[model samples]
Target chain A: MVALRRAAGEVGRSVAVHTRARPAQPQLHPNPWDTYHHTVIEPRRRLGLDAVRRGMERGEIRDDLDVELVGDLFTGPLLIRTVIRPGATLEPGLAERIVDTVLEGLRPRT
Target chain B: MVALRRAAGEVGRSVAVHTRARPAQPQLHPNPWDTYHHTVIEPRRRLGLDAVRRGMERGEIRDDLDVELVGDLFTGPLLIRTVIRPGATLEPGLAERIVDTVLEGLRPRT
Candidate 1:
């Protein structure tokens, strides 16, 4: 009787452990709409922040740009509108904002 | 006396005509400074106006851009800052002005 009881206890413990086990973490693929839906690009959110961070580390942006970020990424032209439409252009003073965003995005994720 | 007078008159008239013969027109190579010395570019003055005119002829801008210019040339990005300085960017509403300049430059020289 004791042996049977012990076996049941063992089985119960095994089931409990299994119920508490961690589930698989899903791999993240950046969606294009989620990635580039913004009129201006956000490098970090888009997964291209790595290059900006690398560039910041390399001093390309800080050298001529009079500034530096946590990483070595160039925040300026790293995200210029590749195609400014015929009747449209970015608002005045927005380039600097884009530059700032690109640089900040390059900051090493702690 | 009449023959002598006629000969002298003919010689004078001929000499005047020789002096006044149309001066040779100089071949113009656009000077870089002359072509693009402004804060914003002027397409016609730059000697690149020909391309703009051709683009206007093709109707490419009118079809998609909601507007047509003297030339099919796109005045917008065609004159964007190839490099916006680190501390710099264009002023407000200047893009449309640049577009206008590019279009006017494209107007066929009648």
Candidate 2:
């Protein structure tokens, strides 16, 4: 949970910084989507994947889990709020709530 | 689970249709984001919320679960793949997998 929280926090902070730096007008680029994926999505995805991997190593997560899908579950909702759907507020502790909910679901059952 | 599956399938089909109809170039609109929210996001979100409500009433989901967050967990991963992250493939049975995984976690414990 701590690793996941750190990963989520880092991604949230980076995205917040990026959102603030974005220009009002949409900029013309060869492929803004690709650029965004390379710059923001990929790195964050790696962070999430790493967190999930570590959790599995510690026997906190299920051994049979799909690592990528688990990562998406952790970050996708928060990402939608921050990037895709700007109207939704990133309330305090939203990331932690997301992490807790997903982890609770994903944790190994006795 | 049936209600949630129906809701998810409807949202996925509608999104597929919308994606096919979208122009190659980004269209000029006064508020495309708001338009999308009204036309797509809002309606789909409501469907997910309804599904969660129905699950609770049926005793399939926990009574204390946050409907909105649970809804997000069900749909957010698929949404990111289809709409936000276009490169990812929406493989067959992906929706069902997401639904089952989340439902397993959220279901009432005896």
Candidate 3:
């Protein structure tokens, strides 16, 4: 019984000692999804999405050319007013009609 | 009445024309918070927080020197093993005691 116990302890000790003596591998960088997630999606989604959505849903109902949606809300309204910012129109109905048409384009294809 | 209406229309038209003729201001870069938001906080929180939390909470309760807690949940376990991973110990209790101490350190500073 003593011999069996000591042998087991010795085995565990040796395995521990061996592992402790080894050096660590360095963490690799420029990891694939990290690059895309950080550069492309994260910032664009984190900041831009909320900003655009807020502008569209509130106040002046501003709009954009840059629809960086994850899925496809690709075709949304286009407003020269908000995009142009403190922008103007030649005729009032001209801008409104353009906006309505752009919005209609976004409807899911039936 | 006609004069009053015409004058109002003319005011609106001229204001519109004037705004359209103006040049757009270049988007200001290096907006103070933008730098910190993009570089300092966002990336750190987005990747490191999730990774460290996952590594610690899951598989092995891995730990760190970088306790960048927003409010301060500092002082977590120290692992020579999972941190050193596939790692081992001279004495069984050594790692456990150290981990317990580190964990205790995080206990609300109380």
Q: lDDT winner among the candidates?
A: 2
Least accurate 10 contiguous residues by lDDT in model 1 chain B: B77-86
Top candidate, metric TM-score: 2
Which whole-number lDDT from 0 to 100 does residue A6 have in model 3?
A: 33
Candidate with more favorable, higher lDDT: 1 or 2: 2
Model 3, position A14, has a per-residue lDDT of 30
Candidate achieving the largest DockQ: 2
True contacts kept of each: 0.00, 0.23, 0.00
* Residue pairs with clashing backbones, model 2: none
Q: Model 1 over residues B1-110: C-alpha lDDT tens digits?
A: 22322332333232223222312211132343232323222322233334333333554222222122221122212221222111223344333333332323211223
Clashes of 1: 10
In model 1, state the lDDT of residue A32.
36
> Which residue ranges in model 1 land beyond 4 Å of their true spot?
A1-36, A39-50, A60-110, B1-110
lDDT at B98 for candidate 3?
28
Listing candidates in order, what is each one's chain A TM-score?
Answer: 0.24, 0.73, 0.27
Displacement of residue A7 (Cα, Å) in model 1 is 59
Collision pairs in model 1: A52-A73, A55-A72, A55-A73, A56-A72, A56-A73, A57-A72, B55-B72, B56-B71, B56-B72, B56-B73
lDDT string for model 2 (A42-81, tens) is 7867876887787777776675768888777776666656
List model 2 lDDT by residue over B7-70, tens digit each: 7666644554464344343334537656775786677668767877887787776667677777
